[model samples]
Target: MRIALFFALILFHFSSISQSTDERAIREVLAQQVECWNEGDLECFMEGYWKSEQLVFIGSKGLTYGWQQTLDNYKKRYPDKSAMGILSFELIIVEPLSEDFWTVIGKWNLKLNSDNPNGHFSLIFRRLGDEWVIVSDHSS
Candidate 1:
């Protein structure tokens, strides 16, 4: 019984470490996205998202489905570097839903020459293979 308890503690320790690592990785992805956006590289910005047809995004306009569609929408909305602006994020919560899924709640801001647009976002990230990517996003 003592041996079993020891093994369980070991497993719990490793799980906690793994969870912390995963959370850091997710935060890095978001940071990279912000860097890409600030550089006015939409393609690079999209790299943080799941490149799948099942990906979903909800914005001020409405709900958009698919990776290509979302990229297209971004391109159309922010046509130039001036419109893309400098992006930043303030994360509120990063909660693990399961071993391979997480939910993030945050606020995003875009500072442009004329105006700064800011909004709150909730994102669902999934571990697709070895990398974590945003599978669903709802921003307003």
Candidate 2:
């Protein structure tokens, strides 16, 4: 009976590890976003987002449609190094929406020489091709 129980525990542990592997992959994607932002690489940062025209990004100014529009907006709003100082994200929630989708809720903070701007953001990510990319983002 003890041996059977041990095997059951081992199986449970393996299942838990398997489940967490996906979460870890999602987190790695998130971490790459942070690293790219910190490095002041907007293009690299944009890699985390879906490249399709259907991708959406909502911000204080309003909603932006299309990946180019989103990139344009980012360039306009953070026009210089001073404005784009440093970007950091504090993940508040991360949950699997389905086998290939995830919902992420977090706070984004930017430190600038003039002022620090921070807001809450929620993003819907989907596993596309070989990586996870944001399909939709809403920030306030």
Candidate 3:
């Protein structure tokens, strides 16, 4: 019984450490995206997303698949720096779905061309090897 208890304690400690590390990485990924967007670098902003054809993005228009397609849509929507504007996010929730998956909810606010456009977003991230990449995004 003591051996089992000792093993259980070790398992719990390992899980706690893993979760903290994952949360930090995920936060960094989201922060990098905001920084890239604020710098008017749409291409860099896309780095936070999974660079796969299977990746999905849902925006005001509709659903778009593939990294290049999503980048194209962003470029089309925000043609210039004035359009892209300053981007900020209010993270509401960051919950783990599994060991390698997480779901994040946040509010995105953009200050652009005299318009303050704000909306809610829900993002799903998957650990691809080491780093986390957003697999699916839904923003309104």
Candidate 4:
């Protein structure tokens, strides 16, 4: 019984360590997206998402499916550097749903030239190989 308990503890410890590492990596991806958006690099910001037609994005405009469509929408909404403005994100929660999935809840703000648009968003991310990519996003 003691031997079995010892192995169980070891497994739990290693599982926690792996989850912690994954959490950090996920945060890094979000941080990079923020940097990209602030720099008015729409293309770079899109890199955080999965580049597949299966991807889904929900915004005030409506539901947009596919990676290319989402990128196009962003480009249309924010045409130039002035329109992109400074991007900021207030992350409320980053919860791990499973070993391979995470749900991120956050607020995003963009200080545009004429108006400031701020809203809350929830993103579903999936671990693919060595990286985590946003598979679905709901923002309003």
Which residue pairs does candidate 4 place in steric collision? none
Give lDDT tens digits, candidate 3, residues 70-110: 99999999997778999999999998999899999999999
Model 3: lDDT of residue 81: 77
- In order of listing, the candidates' clash counts read 0, 0, 0, 0
lDDT of 4 at 74: 94
Could you estimate the TM-score for every candidate?
0.97, 0.85, 0.97, 0.96
- Candidate no. 3 TM-score: 0.97
In model 3, the Cα lDDT at residue 107 comes to 98
| Residue-level lDDT tens digits of model 1 in 6-104 | 999999999999999999999999999999998889999999999999999998888899999999999999997888989999999998999999999
Against the true structure, candidate 1 has what lDDT? 0.95
**Consecutive 10-residue window with the lowest summed lDDT within model 4:** 108-117
Report every candidate's CA lDDT: 0.95, 0.87, 0.95, 0.93
Clashing pairs in 2: none
List model 4 lDDT by residue over 76-132, tens digit each. 988988889998899999989998999999999988878888999999999999999
* Clashing pairs for predicted structure model 1, backbone only: none
Model 3 segments beyond 4 Å from truth? none
Give the candidates in order of lDDT, highest first.
Answer: 1, 3, 4, 2
